[model samples]
Target: MTNELELKQWYQLLFGKIDSALLELKDYDGNYYWDSVDPNSLRYFVSNIVGTPWQNHMGLSLLSVTDRKLSPQSIYNLMSTINARLKNLFAAAELSEMVEFNYSVVEKYLTGSLMPDHTDRQRQSFLTAYGSFIFNVSKWITTQFTNEQQSYFSKFLFPKLPFDNRDFSVRTKALDVAKETRKTETSAVTPQLPEIRAESHFRWNQVHRLRKAMRDVLEKARHDRITLPLEFSYDESEYTNERWHFVLWDKESFGRYYKVGTSSENEVFLEFVRAENLDDGRPGDGLWFLEILRLRLIGIWDQEYLEDNERLKIVEYLNQWGYEDAVQGQAPFQIRNPGLLTQSVFIVRNSRKFDKLLINLEPIYVACTFARFALDIITSSGARMNELLQISYDKNCCIVTVDNSVTPPSKNYIYRLIPKGREEEENYYMPEEVYRFMSDIVNLLKESYNSSSIPEVEYSAATRKHLMSKKRYIFQYKGRHINEFTINAIIRFLLHGTIIQTSEGNQVVLKAHLLRHAFATHAVQTEKIPIDIVKSLLHQKDISVTEYYSAPTHQQISDTVG
Candidate 1:
């Protein structure tokens, strides 16, 4: 029913817009053009073929062949129909690949109208052949298209695909297999909460020792016992000209010498100047400094001191002490802290003036204390790092409610946080001990700043925009909001040098988000809390997600059966 010129105009309009959008397209990690083989190529890959589950059987070439057989109007109709339906399913500020398409959407709009008389198996096969075409169109619309383009496509696209009223079966073997696989995979990957709980106690003991040593350094720096440009003499002949050095020492030696100094550029440069062979294994006097210094730097040091190119040099220096790829990996040094350095210190390799140099440890002490308190709160409350960082002091975010109905009065510590995916405020409950700890931290912040109340400032997460109205976050240092990187760095600091292995023999790398998983698992499996209640506590939209967190172990299943 369409004229030849009209069909040509539609093709030109649709392809032109798609090509324009593709020019600026990026993947979830901001890699240009999804890091495709050819950035300008419009080809798409279909990994799932109908009969072949193990190999990709089709690509854009197959779709091109199919297009050649169709009339121009039919091709335009097919493309427009798919685009129109997919636009309706698009969510704002979400990735195209992450959108979960329901069965009804896939069936009614995609495969159903095209093959009404075909069996479910036949329709699935048909979809297998053409699914890439639909996916590529959907990706273009959701990820690349502008609001104006989306509106035009939705409103002025071709007529809807014809639909039938016949009943379709809901249950399928593929769906059942997928559900079972998901459950099994989730259970296998979920860290055992009991192991984490036991390991946490040991880690905290190590942290306490490190904290005491840091305090000692701060006190000595204040009293002028430890002077900067600190030199360690070893034979005094073989002088190394490196400006910065990273020294690795045994854990017990960490408390003996915890010195750190900064440069004139306000950069904290840690070094252990040795004139003797490093393999000689003499007890290096200033050897134990870099371990704690690395942790402190990760937690508080400003990242602007080192350029991207300079990071390579720092990584190279760290590698000299057997810390290969330490800066690039999940170690504390990888974290980027936005907080400003309150005091600057640097190490001179072979400078003659060593006595006159003095580096203040007050900033390091404050940063260490902040990191400790933040970790305590995170472990106790099991809050998402961003949710905790965004807590507003001015908004009365924490509330205490007394339940007098019990034999002795009990108080509930409730905190209001704007959880991810939802804009409305949700209440998170904490223990009395955690509430008291939070109060002490608030007092410490107020006293440190010489103010009656904590300062209010805007805080934003790096990944997504937080929807909270109140911007005054309480977890800030020196007028800067503490970031997720800093919190994770604190975790790495606490667990440094200690290896905790999983059941699968893989080493455990502690992170702030992992603590969240530990919390959910403990609540559901250990505490015996009902799954639905745990779902409410986590503010999850679907019970299925909570189910994954609460999946029982093989041992638990065995015990139940027994």
Candidate 2:
């Protein structure tokens, strides 16, 4: 939770009109964008915190941008000399200016491709982690600093050069006011509203997008050999304007026709038909039916989902059992081996082969599978691990309970897990491995950790917020902060191990996320799965994130044209 006091720092910084100091992060139209410093200053700002040697590089780049020290070409050449070529890492002043010049351009520029959904439970968990106070302070400060005319507290809190040591009282008052102002500003901002319209649920400008979504659906329909109606009714009801219901008729099934409708506007075409249409006693229902239609039009559903879902079903079912062997040993992981968790996953997976199908090991398979499934759910769900662990297996379907830490600390986040492809499943669904992993975690936590005799510590909303704080570094490796250097090092190592050839003749080394990226990029490039499925797998709220990661690696892109 970002307290009023915490937000004051950046608020004071901006009020002071200082460029080189720290700034807080803020939500700009549902996304976070930091502003307030000059182009040169911004480089130093980011460099000091994000990268160590930013000043010299920026100074050199500054000379290059202006063509004073070297030709622009020479600057580019000089930049190329750097060993780790960072894309979108070094932002020039003009590019930053262009970001504000047009909002849509800014829309295209999202780091992490993450949207700040204040209302989203998972996002709230994250916001609490990153500290709303500092973020708000930073945003306000950036705005105040960037403008030609500085804001109210500039003269007092942040006096210009030739300052005296005796005037502490005046500066402190100004700082207090700045913090108050930020508290007002952040509290004033609201969450993004659901885009709903008569034509489609999205904004009007998304007509092209609707067409694309339809193209995917029609293709699926044709594949199932399921002919679709001329027009579908989505949210024909008075209250809900976004629910989409497609009047699809499968010629192959006994029901002969399934009016596939999705209450969820963002619902994929496959998920749309899968939900109610599952167990409708029709021959070849569910994903099997959807795939037949999809394949008929697009030629493939990749059957990746079938493997994943089969895994999910086993996991989810095992999660229902609430079982695990008593863990008598020490933690399977050591602080020295963070990647050990990743490696251990494969080891555990291969330990028991899937060959013993329809047997006692099925329960164990389900347990392990759901553990992995739970892990995937949190990653893709974008929720804190603890909040994700709070998912109630007691519920008919695993439903995640979200308790907000800051702002309205009393309110908990409530959301149902949504499954992909198979609409016949729960509202919110977990992948198979997550359920298995979570189940294992439950057993592991039970015997290993002392619950009743555990040392006392506050587990209130405040403490929860502290645990969830982004700065606290849950993903942090031992003796390593979750900063750029470590992240870059990991990516570099992963890249050195893998390589991809793009269509444009660029040979790019594959990074850690490259496989996940491949899952997304290959899906769209191949035109195999619908765009929605690709987005779901990638956990994108909008296509922009999809657009960034969805680009095929060199080889896949090259192979398409070849």
Candidate 3:
């Protein structure tokens, strides 16, 4: 028997603040709703009833009854019975058993007498909500019990509710009744390439415009057309500290400024920049500022405008600012190749300066490039976003295998990826175009680093238990590997202003995972590939999952019905 004191504690935890005969409930938004639910009565409404105000109220009014009323022991016994019935239903091997349990056990607590005036739909809704509430409560109650006590209440130990609280028979019956309705309803379609292509073009165009604006600003600064406070020169008359205010680009009405100075000023500048760029919501304006700053310093050094002492002072400042490779006589850019200027030596050397920098353009630039490359790979190969992001250069991530058995020699481009939730690596087939793209990116990285092979760094994959030391990850910027958040941000930034409407006329938000879905849909629907083949390509364990991607759209449904 369950202890009365413990049951009372559990009751308090489950339902908060029951004053008099009223039971107080809080919605997700923290708003309270009081119902005429009697805690002392033999009958009690089910806990955690969710729906609209009226629906919840109605559901709560329909009580779960037993011979003995409102004691902790009686309530516990009723909940245990419900838990046992649910376990039996979930564990039933045959559909007949499930159907029998539904009628015998489920309908017992949620009897027709409780809602005599309500329709069949209303009764069914209450039944569904009651089952869910009991299941959740049972799970919670099990957590409070000891291991031995849990074993005694075996049903609550691992309570598995059927999908959507509907058994096979219920689903079959529902489908039979709604067959005509489903015919009229349009199934969801995966994202199309044309829409994604348009969005990609928009993003690239924005990047180009930003680059051009940056160059124009740099040219003006170089020629002394506009004065930029690149150095720390205090203005005593104006009572202003030495600061660098970089104006990269500006709209007709409002201008975008990147301010690099003290920590306090950077905070204020960031808010200002956010306000200025609030229209598009694009990130990395601070990164653009840093890039332009690096470029201007290089231009100044190359032009020999500053005297010996002035140049030495600039070098000292660069060293202090955490540019580790900044030598006494050499220019900041000349310390390393311009392409390699934004490497770890520049960014991660000083932790304080890095934090104040707000963002890095190199990572954003690298993320953008990888995202572009990944768009082709994901759409073509049906690779998961994480699988592509976790590819390591040291592991021979991409390989070309030739088949001699065929009449003509065929080359297969295989990308080895650690699939999500699996420790063992899997091979993903790719097109020659994708292979060439990967090669080009690899070559570019090698060139930038001025090395024969891509530099090896420590990488940690989501599936792995430990960090992979000395692995050259292809999807990396500087010393850091680009993450899903950065990639998603870049996708959103690129898709800005490019509108793709849904069948219901709502605007569609593009994501990287949606591209994988698009690839699957295109393979099965557009290419007329076999379901098994599509499933294999998508690396899906179940064929049914793959079929979901190829579901007919509204237009297809309309045409078929016509």
- Cα RMSDs, all models: 15.4, 25.5, 20.0
Per-residue CA lDDT of model 3 for 1-562, tens digit only, reads 2254235532454343222122332333543323222332213333432221222222222232211123333343434444333444334423232223344444432343332443444334434544545555455434444666445444312223444435434434444555322322212324346556545544444444444444555566569865442222111111111122232322211122323223221211111122123334333232223432333343224344546765566666555433434553434232211322233332322222333332234433444456567776777788887778766665477678999999799999888877755666789988797677677678768866788888766553322313234567786655555555555545544443344555555444456776666677667666789989888888888788777755555666566699
- Show pairs that collide, candidate 1: 261-345, 261-346, 262-345, 262-346, 263-345, 263-346
Residue-wise C-alpha lDDT for candidate 1, range 121-175, written one tens digit per residue: 4443334434545444445555545787566444322222233223234235334
RMSD of 2: 25.5
lDDT of each: 0.47, 0.31, 0.47
Q: Per-residue lDDT tens digits of candidate 2, residues 76-109?
A: 3333322121223223213322113232322222
Identify the superior model by TM-score, candidate 1 or candidate 3: 1
For model 1, the stretches where C-alpha displacement exceeds 4 angstroms are 1-332, 340-381, 447-450, 462-466, 554-562
Provide the lDDT at 193 for model 2: 8
Compare the candidates by TM-score and give the number of the best one. Answer: 1
- Lowest-scoring 10 consecutive residues by lDDT in candidate 2? 188-197
Worst window of 10 by summed lDDT in candidate 3: 263-272
Error of 3 at 263 (Å): 5.6
lDDT of 2: 0.31
